[model samples]
Target: MSITLKLAWKSLLNRKTTALLTILTVAISVILLMGVERIRTQAKSSFANTISGTDLIVGGRSGQVNLLLYSVFRIGNATNNIDWKSFEEFSNHRSVDWAIPISLGDSHRGFRVMGTNHSYFEHYQYGQKQHLSLAKGEEFDGLFETVIGSDVAKSLGYDIGTEIIIAHGISDVGFSRHENTPFKVVGILAPTGTPVDKTVHVSLEAIEAIHVGWESGANLGNEPSKEQLLQMDFQPKQITAMLIGLKSKIQTFALQRQINTYKQEPLSAILPGVALHELWGMMSVAETALLIVSVFVVVAGLMGMLSSLLTSLQERRREMAILRAMGARPRHVFTLLVSEATVLTSIGIICGIGGMYAMLAIAAPIITANYGINIALSGITSHEWMLLGFVQLAGVIIGFFPALRAYRQSLSDGMTIRI
Candidate 1:
């Protein structure tokens, strides 16, 4: 090692406590900055790829965003339902390959209940065109049988054959319960790290069967017996939304136009990617706010690090005299000060990244459960590397003032020790 580097290392070791604290401060700031960026990137990935392998999302005429929200993410109620005839007609269209019907507006213990056919399990895709797989048991086969997502099973402690009651509405409390018409859990889907993880899937017939005794959202006459309910037809009159897969990519726009201009009922068909981009555009402001706050935190950390290095300069003035007496030029003293800062910052950056990985490893499950957002444990991106480069640049810039102070101290001391 060079003499200057050796001296710089010795000086940092002498103020071990202060140097360590400064490094830790920078490390924490890096953690927050990297965490925010990772979440933002992964959130966009998860939300955009929530449903793939489909050409378009078809729903009753409403805002494209709203239809995507209620149909794919199960976020809100549909303003209208497309009649079963309309769905069948579109499903049989020449340009369409497959269509999966979706029925919403019911809940089971705060988790949304989605009524769909076997086609959903067959055609729906997520996370890079990955199909849904059952973690346990098989798909629902009969009326009142249901398949649950991983989050639903984990949250409710449900297993195959476990019966759960459906709620009248999508609220956690105050919704009329579907006590008599309990559904048996037939399958549990593996976690996709998407909205699908929070849904309860049943047949469209099951949705109809449960609402048999209810009219206008309330039970009017006496409820039917189990025998009468079994004998009753279970055909759904309408559906909240439908996902259409086209036979040819070129037919997408043409099919979308056809759906939009359908004479039977007003309908909207949106490309999943386009709608996802629109949604992200609307949410970009909040994302920017988070990034700005994290940047400020990093700046504060750099300032704290600067303050600590500056405070240590007073005690090092005598050391500067000794170095000058040893034939070290003023630039040498300056280099020593700057090199020490560089070493501390390099270590801080390494520690910050390690700490971030540790934090993410521990917080992944909790985040998925609470927010339904997946934070992947992956390598740093080019953008993150650029962020680190900027941090190092800030360290070098912050070191400049301290290096200057040391340079002046060396010139003035001139072999005379200051008290």
Candidate 2:
């Protein structure tokens, strides 16, 4: 075994460039495969953690999945708004444990602005029912005071006292500005790894205050400054969605049905887990496609390694004959070749894993900023470890073919040149 290993090392050294190139090819493919798997799994976990502890997400009449998408995930726009009266009714229900009203339809520099009541800080939870906590300053105390999400504060470089104006609509630009009403940043929430991290939260009254003076088609009149607008009434009459937690889990279905059949406003209530699962089912198709492509790439890389080994066999035959004359058996030659392949492939796998970690570390901020998805740098999961085992198995299987061919040739040649 030692002799075989020594020979394997020498042979790899002799064709260092070819061996290194093969390793690199396999390494890149492995990195991509592992990265895709990691991102897919982590993304699903992050999505699931977005609205933990909230039994049901109540909104205006729409598809249950759509409500979850628009309200919790910030993936789409709500088709309609739930009347404030209906939200109050739900909040005042006997089975209700907590209610957090949300008013959307505004953005500041591409970050969604969420207008919600102070109860949001108390009741809303994420990531295993972790309560929302302020990282700096206190929660919104006045209607004009804002509590920014972690991503918003970090990306915008805003501190506790920075003031911001909410846009009239969700447009990034070309919309009427709420020039008269600007909110002060009173607090910054800790990172929740959810859509909440990307939101700019303020009092629901702040949402109403921004749109009060400007009527539809009204020209941008010389409006009072933002400070003056703060002195005016800022009570809200409507909201985009509300999150409801029931005193008893059994009451969830009953309340959901009631919200869906409300007389005042057509509303929808969705079980967060069920809606998230449906969303993931749709997302899994893309994940599967990515996995397929990664498998193909890995196969191609293995084939490249095999082709390189086969092409080098001719040059290695003379060396093999010398070893055979030195009392090296054909079995030893076979073991040597297979071991070399295994070592090369294992190196590739290691490099691939290291590369993935480095890439994730570098791209974490960009991913969160652009897609609102947080890719955590947690240790490898069981599935990922299984993948590593599979890669090692594949390496051995692919290497066996070339090793067998080398063994056959060494045996048939009988220490004599056949060519």
TM-scores, each model vs. reference: 0.97, 0.94
| Candidate 1 C-alpha lDDT tens digits along 12-111 | 8888899899999999999999999999998898797788898999998998899999999999899899899999999999988999999999888889
- RMSDs, each prediction? 1.5, 2.0
**Which candidate leads in TM-score?**
1
Distance from true location, Cα of 296 in model 1, Å:
1.5
Off by over 4 Å in 1: 172-175, 414-419
340, model 2: CA deviation in Å? 1.3
Q: Which ten residues in a row have the lowest lDDT in candidate 2?
A: 216-225
User: Compared to the true structure, candidate 2 yields what TM-score?
Assistant: 0.94
